[model samples]
Target: MTQSMATRATVTVAAELTDRCDRCGAAGKVKIGLAGGGELTFCGHHANRFADGIGTAAERVVVESGFGWKGAQPI
Candidate 1:
């Protein structure tokens, strides 16, 4: 795969605690992987507020909405 696709493939749910919001510095509940090899974390409110921008720039978006649901697994 290309470098960009490789970066996108690397996006994974943080196994530890949640990250800090990039906007308000609150506890982050959402994580977005950018088109390149960068990521942005945000709380629920900020994620909602910046949904459009995130949707536009993000190659992958993962939100931890308190369900504690981990990501997919190998079959």
Candidate 2:
């Protein structure tokens, strides 16, 4: 497979397998990768709450809203 295709496949798998928030254990809606190292997972609520602090330091940030997932149901 081509490099971009492989990267897409990897991202799909990661999305399927990623666990819940590191803080409250709710389903993660945002993923933050650090420039130095490590990563953080947070639900939308916590992600927004902490964005001012950690967002500035992140090297990469991926956010998928709750409405974008197959498993998410209406409130």
Candidate 3:
């Protein structure tokens, strides 16, 4: 059977909670708003490890785009 829109929405909301990877800080496709009001963006690793911890500690952890930490660009 097909899922209803309401069900999908609920699933979406739940999925949002599992976005980023806490360990490596990998940002996922969707960006979610945190409880405290801040933002957090992780890649994949970091989010998984500390997702719960970070979420509780801060409001949000926004994921950053572009170059590396050292600000180095590829040739």
Tell me the number of clashing residue pairs for each predicted model: 0, 0, 31
Q: Candidate 1: deviation at residue 53, Å?
A: 0.6
Q: Taking the tens digit of each residue's C-alpha lDDT, what string does model 2 give over 1-75?
A: 221111111112144326589999998876767777888887767766675555456666666743232212112
lDDT of 1 by residue, 1-75 (tens): 221111222334554436899889988877888888798987767876665566567787776645232222111
The pairs that clash in candidate 2 are none
List, residue by residue over 1-75, the lDDT tens digit for candidate 3. 342211111012123434564335454632334564655555544543443444345443333343121111112
Residue 7 alpha-carbon offset, candidate 3, angstroms: 19
Best by TM-score: 1
Clashing pairs in 1: none
Clashes of 3: 31
Please name the candidate that would achieve the greatest lDDT relative to the true structure: 1
**TM of each candidate vs. truth:** 0.63, 0.60, 0.32
